[model samples]
Target chain A: MRNIFIIFKRELKSYFNNPLAYVLIIIFSLLSMGLTFVIGDFLKMNDASLTSFFFFHPWIYMIFGPAIGMRLWSEEHRMGTTELLLTMPISAWQAIVGKFLAACVVLAAALLSTISIVFTVYYLGKPDGQMIVSGYIGSFLVGASSIAITCAISAFTRNQISCLLVAVAVCFVLVLAGFPRVTEFLRPNFPALADIGNSVSFWWHQSEMARGIIRLQSPVYLLSLIGFSLYLTGVIIRGKRS
Target chain B: MIDIANLTKHFGPKVAVDNLSLSVQKGQVLGFLGPNGAGKSTAMRMITGYLPPTSGSIVIGGIDMLEDPNAAKALIGYLPESAPLYQDMTVEGFLSFAAELRGLDGQRRRDAVGNALATCFLEGVRRQSIDTLSKGYRHRTCLAQAIIHDPEVLILDEPTDGLDPNQKDVVRNLIRHMGKTKAIIFSTHILEEVEACCTRAVIIDRGKVVADGTPDHLKRHAARAGSVTVRFQNAPGGLRQDLEKLKYGARLEAVETAGSTLSAVVYPKTKADASNLSAEIYELARSRNLALSELHEEPGRLDEMFRELTSQNKV
Candidate 1:
């Protein structure tokens, strides 16, 4: 536990030291808010809830999560610091968990930066505070899940650009799995395929939480996705030494 | 404090490190020497627990590395080849991070970082990011990270690889000083470093141990180790024939003749004859009324010994 915290502190400090993190946060904030206002038609919806605001989160997180997580293990391997860090007195699992949490915190910060939208909803009318909190929670989980997948992919390669490309490709498929058009097409010809798509889709679970319906299955699915990806990261790192 | 036995690593069909075994006790510095692709770095990685061996065991400070790596690793300070470090961190920040990872904290962590900075002469760049430092400074910063916890065992791979001459001298002196209390194993391609800091030297070839002994003992294996060189002025005509016919002299070659001055070298018949060959030549020069300018037995050269041991054509 102590070793994990030490690694986490160093990783977080490194993120802040680089200008990439600030740029990512600013871009994520502008894109999410801009999409919410322009495309979602925030004022014309005539609803006090932040349904329009939470709608664009999965698409925005698909790009920004990999942007932040691409450097986690890829930089370590590129700079040859994997040997230095692995030879230290900490276990590989500790290092993986530490870096994963640090990147998740960066994602969390990007998610939190859109809290002003919640205030805008409250000022216009009496918005459901519990629903707004649930929406933020659900959005943060989607971002965390995206970062975790990217972190796992980053462990497989030393090139950050390759890591980002592969991760975005994977996340794009996940986002498309349960899109309305795809699901509508699959539901008629292949009902079973549509069910599997919804089961693994990031949009499916996130939209459930956005509606303030905290079903046990949605949080459980997202948490397990995060857990499985991190476990895969540990496996890849251990495989490198052998 | 480090004992490795039957260590081997095979990458696909090619064997990297093969059945290598060596040990280092407290107060002993073992110099690891090998030609390129001889598996020196691979063996060090196995010992440091960065890479697991295919079939072997590494015991550091009496702790088995494979079974309990964290405990074993805690006692070791390793500097990998080329001195890899976090380039984005300040020197002090990196050292402190290393100290913290080693379980030091608060005042102890501060003291460890300070001592490492002073020891490696990194005080000038304490606040500077590692990317801005020169190669020599970057190398020393990694070295400082290795020694931050003052570990009981130190494994350094080519610690002075890219340093300038003065920096190399300082690093060599530091290694010599630190070897007194810690078990140290460092790999280097430079032959002089064996004599400078190592108490024992091991040379490997094709992933196998070829020579293991004191530097002087290994040097004695050189082809020309026991030969005697003699210089004379106004020497007699049959000097080469006379020197060749001596009882202990195996062969004699006249090296140079400029004007009335001549220099010749006599090879000994056996290792035991080297000590007496020089005296025999001096006595011969005295009796023949020859002016003997210089006569001395040649010590073996480490570079020659290294080349001979690691040469690919050796049977």
Candidate 2:
């Protein structure tokens, strides 16, 4: 546990030390803010709820999550630092969790910085505080799972561009699985596949939490996604230990 | 202390290290000598518990690396061939991170980082980010990170590879200082490094150890254990044949002429009996009433021995 914190602190410091962290945050903020105001007509809605802001998180993270996770292991392998890291006393699991949680902290900070949107909604009208909090929680989980998937793919290849492309493609599929058009299209020809897609979709579970439902299974489903992705990442990293 | 036995590593159908075995005791600086692709780095990785061997055992400080990697690794400080480093980190920060990863905390971590900085002469650039430093400084930073914990066993692969002459000397001195109390195994293709600091040396070729001994012992493996060179005032005809027939306690392996000078190299039947060949040659020249211009014996050459032992085309 202590070793994990040591790695986590180093990784977190590295993110802030590099220009990538600020660049990622700026891109995420611009895209999310732009999607909410321009596309969702957030200001014209006149409603206090941040539905537009919360709705764009999956798409925003699809770009920024891979941006953050692409360098997690790919850069290590490329720079030969993997040899230094694996030879240390810490286990592979500690290194994985440390890097993962450090990335989560960065995502959390970016997400929390959008509290200005909450303030705007509050000043305009009375918003359901419960739904807004639940929406933030859902967005956080979705962002974490996206980062996990990106990290898993990053571990398999030393090229950061390849990692980003493959992660974006897979996340696109996972995101589309929950869309109404994809589900409706699959329902007529592939009923079982459609059911599986809907059940495993990121948006399907996130929507329940965004609506303030807070079902036990929704968080469980997201947690399982995180666990499964991280497990696969661990396996891939262990496969090339030292 | 480190003990490795029958270590073998295979990348699919290709073998990297083949049935390699060696032991490094405390206070021993074993120089691992090999050309590129000779499995020097692979063997070091296995000894440090980073790579699992295909079939072998590594015992570090009495802890088997395969069975208990963490404990074994805790005792080892490794500097890989590339001097792996995070370029974004400052020297102090990176060394501190390494110290923390080695389980040091608070004041202990501070002291370890400080000691490493002082030892590696990195105090001036401790606050400088690694990427901005010169290549020599980056190499020193990597060395500092490796010794931050002061482990009992040190496995360094090509530690002084990219450094200038001064930096190389500093690193060599540091290795010699550390070798007093720790078991250190460093690999380098540079022959001078083995002669300069290594108490014992192992020359590996094609994943197997071809020779292992002290510097002098390995030097004697040269084709000519020792030689006597004499420049005669008068260039005698058939001088080469006469020198070869002198019956010096050892066989005259080669007699050559260079600019009216004659030099004959003698090889003892065994390395132990190479004592009086030069003296015998001098007495023979005196008895023949041949006034000598120059009479000197050349000890074995390490580079020649290395080339001969590790030559790739040897049968």
Candidate 3:
């Protein structure tokens, strides 16, 4: 546990030590708020809720997740620091979890920066506080899931650009899996395929939580996805050592 | 403090480190020498537990690496070939991280980092970020990271590589000084480094132990070892013929006569003492009334022995 914390502290500090983390947070904040009010039609909706803000999270995280997590393992391999890190007394799992959590914290900071939108809704009128909390939770889970997938992809390659590109493509597929149009198209010819796609889709689970439903399966699905991807990351790293 | 037996590693079908075995006791500096692609780095990686061996056992301080790697690794300080470091981190921050990973904390961690910086001569750049530092400082920072915890076993892969002559001398002296209590294994193709620092040297070729002995012992394996050279101002008629017929358990390998000055090198027929052979030649020269300028025995060369041991043709 102490080893994990030590690694986590270093990984997190590394992110902030450069301009990347600050730039990423600023961009994510601006994009999410801009999309919510402009493309999302938040003011036009005339509703006392953050529905428009929550709706754009999955899309914003598609880029933010990979950008934040892409360098986690890829940079280590590129700099040849994996030999120094893996040779330490800590287990591979500890290092993986440490880095994963560090990225998650960065994602959380980006998500929390959008709390101004919640204050706007509260000032305009009374909104369902529970539902708003659930919406933020759902957005974080979506971001965490994307970051986890990016971590696994980063472990597979030593190039940060390739890691970012490949992770974006994978997250694109996951978001599109249950996209309303794609699901509608598949529902006519392959109804069962549509159900299966929705079952594994990040969009579907996150949308459920954003609706204030908070089903047990929603958090479970996203958590399990993060768990499985982190497990795969450990496997790839250990394979490299041998 | 390190006992490795039959260590092997196979990258797919290609054998990177074959069935190699070596051990180092406390207070011994073992210089690992080999030509390029001789598996020196691969062997060091396995010994440090950075790469798992295909089939072998590594016992560090009596702790089995395979069965309990964390405990075994805790006792080892490894500097990889490239001396990798987090380029964005300050020298102090990096050393603190390494100390923390080694289980040091609070005052102990601070003290360890400080001691490492002082020991590696990195106190001048403690607050400087790694990427901004020069190559020599970067290498020393990585080295400081290894010794922060003051591990019992130090495994350095080409620690002095890419350094200037002055830097190399400083590092070599540091290794010799630290070898008093720690078991150190350092790899280098530079033969003189082995002579300068190693108490014992092991030469590997094609993933196998080709030669292993003290520096002097390995030098004796050179072809020219136990040979004598004689330089005379005045040449004697039939000097080569007389020297060949004298038969003092030696053979006249070559003789050069240059404008009244004659020089000859005599090789011992067997592994006899070069002094004994030279004494016999001295007697013959004195009897022949020859004016000899210089006469001495060659101590042999490490480069010759290295070439002979690691040559591809040698089985």
DockQ, per model, reads 0.90, 0.74, 0.89
lDDT ranking, high to low: 1, 3, 2
What does fnat come to for each candidate?
0.92, 0.85, 0.92
* Cα lDDT tens digits for candidate 3, A1-242: 99899999999999988899999999999999999898989888888888778887888888999999999999999999999999999999999999999999999888888889989999998899988989989889999999999999999899999999999999989988988988999999999999988988888877778888889988999999999999999999988777
Candidate 3: lDDT of B80? 97
Q: What is the interface RMSD, in angstroms, for predicted model 3?
A: 0.7
Full candidate order by DockQ, most accurate first:
1, 3, 2
Better of 1 and 3 by lDDT: 1
lDDT of 1 by residue, B1-315 (tens): 999999999998999999999999999999999998899999999999999999988999999999999999999999999799898999999999999999998999999999999999999999999999999999999999999999999999999999999999999999999999999999999999999899999999989999999998888889989999999898767776787899899987767878888898889999679989988888898888899999989789999999888886855
Across residues B185-252, which tens digit of lDDT does each residue of candidate 2 receive?
A: 99988889889999999999889999999988898778765665566665578766676665554466
True contacts kept of 1: 0.92
Off by over 4 Å in 3: B286-290
| Chain B TM-score list for all models | 0.96, 0.91, 0.96
TM-score of chain B of 1: 0.96
**Candidate 2 error regions (>4 Å):** B233-242, B249-262, B285-293
Q: Model 3 Cα displacement at B41 (Å)?
A: 0.6
Q: TM-score, B chain, candidate 3? A: 0.96
lDDT of 2 by residue, A106-213 (tens): 998888677778888889999999999999899999889989999899999999999999998888888889877899999999999898887787777677778888
